[model samples]
Target: LNIAALLHDVGKIGVYDSSLRKTTRLSNEEILQLKEHPTIGAGIIKRIDFFHDIAPIVRSHHERFDGHGYPDGLANDAIPIESRIICVADAYDAITSKRTYNKPLSPLKAVEEIERNSGTQFDPEVVSALRNALEPNDLPTVQLNEDDFEEFEIPNECDPDYL
Candidate 1:
């Protein structure tokens, strides 16, 4: 379980876009590309010595509790418990993390969103776990003041590339 979850997003390294990687809404092509991350992650784990049992779990973490998820839609008990655990953890992390697309949600808001999506995009059990796991540190703490971006105007003679 640990091994699989740890490597779950490894495939993302190949086609990752730092600018939009954690956005709430992505273009269709970006969504398609993002879906491949799980497969790529599974493949990386499958080649390991003791990870044979973890491959399927890694591959199916993206699946939803209602069988509407990608790759394989093995719902409820059909999905491994370890995978389910990882699912909740992954969701919590994503919800609480700051991204280019959307600011990180407060713990209360994140829980509400997770609970709202229970049984559709996520497992009810996973939702329960998330409700229990939220902590003060789960929220992002980066403070960006307008002064942080303050800079002198560039000279017209300055080369943009060099600047």
Candidate 2:
């Protein structure tokens, strides 16, 4: 289950469009196709068989805390904790990552956004774990521009939003 959430995005390897990985805004149609990566990941995992439990976690990674999420609008505890954990983890990864639409914010900044949306886009408890995971060692110096090198850094203390 843990590994599934960690690697659920592996199917993204198949997307040919660099735009799929761009940090810029996506059009509605592009967003639609982009969302399919979860289902595509499920498909890929299904053929592999051993990862059956991961398929749904992959499929529901974007589901909302208030039943407003995609593929399915499952609300409340209808979502598995395993899935919810990934939802928070995946979001944290993207915000901290250098994508085409945005540069990585400070970890404090990312947690601020997550804490701001906790009861809405994210689970409050899961949000805590998200912030907790930032132990001076997890920040990735990922190449956002795909050219500029990353300066590896992590912050101490939780953003007030988490408090």
Candidate 3:
């Protein structure tokens, strides 16, 4: 699950930097291109033996509980449990993090947004777990610096050049 969470957006490496870094609203073509990330990421993961099992979960992370999401239209149990968990976590992070397109939202506001989408954009069971988890102390916000990461080369199998 953790591996799936970390690599779920790995396909974005293949996306155009302009589309990802643009501050304005994405054009329809850019939106379509952005939606291809999951499929691209899954393809990359599937090439590596150790991560083969997670490729499906990675591909399905964008799937919605109501079967309206992209890449695949899987709904409910049709989607992997790990993918469903990642979907909720991914949405929460996107809502709370500052991006080129939007300002960061407060954790409370983020939770509210997720709650509003329960059973549609997110799984209700996962939503319930999130609510329960947040009922305790507030989660500490961590600010990540680019310097914190050590440079690493892409593995041969996962490298875009090889793919």
Candidate 4:
């Protein structure tokens, strides 16, 4: 599960830098390309035999509980627990992190957004886990003014020395 979570966005490496760094809404074509990251990420993981078990989790993490997600429209319990958990975690981070396009939301506001989307964009069970996890401080809390984008890279077969 940790492996899947860490590498879930590895496919974003294939995306154009301009696209990833864009400060505005994406165009239709750009959105389609961006949505392919999960599939690309899963494929990359599958090539490593040891990571085979995590491939599906990475692939399905974007699936919505309402069966309206991309790549596969899996609904409710059809999605794996690992994927569902990752989805909630990913959503929380995305909501609370400052990105090129938007300011970060307050933690409280982000939680409300998650609550509002329960059973539609996220699994309720997973959201519950998030709420519980937050209450116990399982997740790290950073000062609002802190810069969170520390640079890091995953070395792959073609770039073993990159990192």
lDDT string, candidate 3, 92-133, tens digits: 999888788887776777888999999998999999899789
Model 3 segments beyond 4 Å from truth? Answer: 136-163
Query: How do the residues 1-163 of candidate 4 rate in per-residue lDDT, one tens digit apiece?
Result: 8888899899887788889999888999999999998899989999999998898898899999999997899999989899999898898899898788878787767877898999999999889878876773444444466554476765686775764
List pairs with backbone clashes in candidate 3. none
Where is model 4 more than 4 Å wrong at Cα? 136-143, 146-163
- lDDT by candidate, in order shown: 0.76, 0.75, 0.91, 0.86
Segments of candidate 1 deviating more than 4 angstroms: 16-25, 133-163
In model 1, state the lDDT of residue 65: 86
Error of 4 at 5 (Å): 0.6
The TM-score measured for candidate 4 stands at 0.83
lDDT of prediction 3: 0.91
Models 1 onward score TM values of 0.73, 0.75, 0.83, 0.83
**lDDT ranking of the models:** 3, 4, 1, 2
Q: Could you tell me how far off, in angstroms, the CA of residue 98 lies in candidate 2 after the best superposition?
A: 1.4
Q: Name the Cα RMSD for model 2.
A: 10.8
**Candidates' RMSD to native:** 8.1, 10.8, 6.6, 4.8
TM-score between model 2 and native: 0.75
Task: After the best TM-score superposition of candidate 1, give how far the Cα of residue 80 lies from its true spot, in angstroms.
Answer: 1.4
